[model samples]
Target: MTKPTEIKALVFDVFGTVVDWRSGVAREAAAFLQRHAPHLDAFEFADIWRREYSPAMEEIRSGRRPYVRLDVLHRENLVKVLKRSGITGATDAEIDELNLAWHRLDPWPDSVPALNRLKRRFIIAPLSNGNIRLMVDMAKRAGLPWDAILGAEVVRAYKPSPQVYSETVDILGLAPAELCLVAAHNGDLAAARRLGLSTAFVVRPTEHGPDQKTDLNAQQAWDFVVDDLNELASQLDASID
Candidate 1:
């Protein structure tokens, strides 16, 4: 077993970890589909769109495509999904506006206060796959108190890619062990752990959906396992005051 690093900064994974993307995207997609293609199941449409998120980026990760911002990937995927839903009448402007749903996501209930508490003790930033613009927009709207926005665009690579996490530590001038990757997903933490960064798994059972089968709980003996960000703040000894 590897000894965990003396944690100082907390680099967060934003999608399901920080903000509630599933609900947010589902809400927006429902509205869009209701207005345009009422026959389609908007909620399921939202789910299917999110399902395409990874494979779209996986192409870039696998060197099958060049690196592009997440917005571009999302737009491409959105169009494909819309086509499948028989909503091909959507204008380019409408498509672009719809894609911005990712930017308008809401934070989980515990995210703001917990992050504020954690911010008292550690340097907190979003180490997300979303680009800087997307993160900045979400942070401003969701009131996420991040000391910095660090992630894929900053490193030009995605998570589990190593370079993403390595560049983040390098940018902070902190050793791998000093930075703890706090996240809801096991894969994200597993990648950080393999790189010698301390890990915290916060369970987000509804991140996928109510009936979600995966990531219902922590999949590893991580440094800290908690129900939400507030518990994480408490576990890390960050005072609410």
Candidate 2:
């Protein structure tokens, strides 16, 4: 393990790492569906919307499409989810409102407090695939104490992409060894580790749902592996108060 003293910044994977996108989206989706399509299942709707996330980003990754912010991909995916649910009469305003559900995601119980503690010790920010506005809205709503937001939109690429990791380290003006990537997903950590960044795997067993089978444990010997952010803070010796 790299000594904690060597890491000057801690960049995070936002969605599913710090926030509970599933429940938050479902909460908003339920209200929207009740008004627009009374027969749809809100949780199912949220799952459907999220299911489109990777393939949409892969289009840009493969050079089949130009890079666009995550909001655009989300809205396009929302349209598909709605259509799949047999909802053909929803107004544009309604769709847009439902789309903002991503911005309103609730943080996991430990996220805010742990982040504030961690912030006292190191620069903390999000290196997510989400756009700047999305991260801002989420941070404000969730009370996350991020020092800055840097990710796919900033780097014009998504996670697991080498540039996303390398460039974010560059933008922070730190060598890869000086920054740590904290995430729930193994692949995200693997990508960061490949680029010489330290990796922390924060377990989020229900990020997918109760039946989730992946990323339940560290798949590799990450620099740190803990159950949640607070534990990570404790390991890093960040004070609770």
Candidate 3:
């Protein structure tokens, strides 16, 4: 295990780890549905849209499709979501507006405070699958104190893909052992650990909603495991502000 003192930077998974994508997307979907498809379930719509995330990225990861920003994929998925819901009359403008929901996600209550604290001691940034614009928009709206954003767009690949982890560490000019991947998903940690990076699991049991069965706890003996980013900051001895 890499010593905690040797970990100079902390990179995070953004969607479910730093922000509550589920609730925020659902809220936006609810408002859009209220105007266009009031009969549909907003949460269900949000879930369906999120379900498409992995498969879409797999296209790029598997080299079946060239890399594109997440925004494009979200718009494409939004069209499918609307059609699946039997609402095909949405204008291109409305579809574009609705797709911005990913940018409007709200952070968990402890996110801002905890990230601010963590930033005091180490270089902190997002190693998310989200594209630059998406991450920038989210950070600005949510007061996330990312020193920089590094992820799929930078590497032209997605998480669990070795390059996404290795390239990011390369971009940071750090030895793999000098950086820690902080994420709520155990699979993400597993990916980083395999690449010789330190790993920290910050559990978010509600990320997939109340009935969420997966990723409810750390799946491995990660270097650090905590209930939330706040606990993670405490574990790292990053004092609260």
Candidate 2: residue 103 Cα off by (Å)? 0.7
lDDT digits (tens) for residues 138-215 of candidate 2 = 999889999998999999998788999999989999989899999999999998999999999999999988999999
Task: Give the per-residue lDDT of model 1 (tens digit) for 33-130.
Answer: 87888888766887899889889888989999989999999999998887777776788888889999999999999999999988877899999999
Judge candidate 3 at residue 111 and give its lDDT. Answer: 92
- Model 3 spans with C-alpha error above 4 angstroms: 238-241
Give the Cα error of residue 235 in candidate 1, in Å. Answer: 0.9
Clashing pairs in 3: none
Residue-level lDDT tens digits of model 3 in 1-241: 6678888899999989999999999998888899888988888899999999999999988999999989999899888878887897788988899999999999999999999988989899999999999999999999999999899899988888999999998999999988999999999999999999999998888898999999988888998998888888887784223
Every model's TM-score: 0.95, 0.97, 0.97
List the candidate 2 regions with Cα displacement exceeding 4 Å: 238-241
Between candidates 1 and 3, the one scoring higher on TM-score is 3
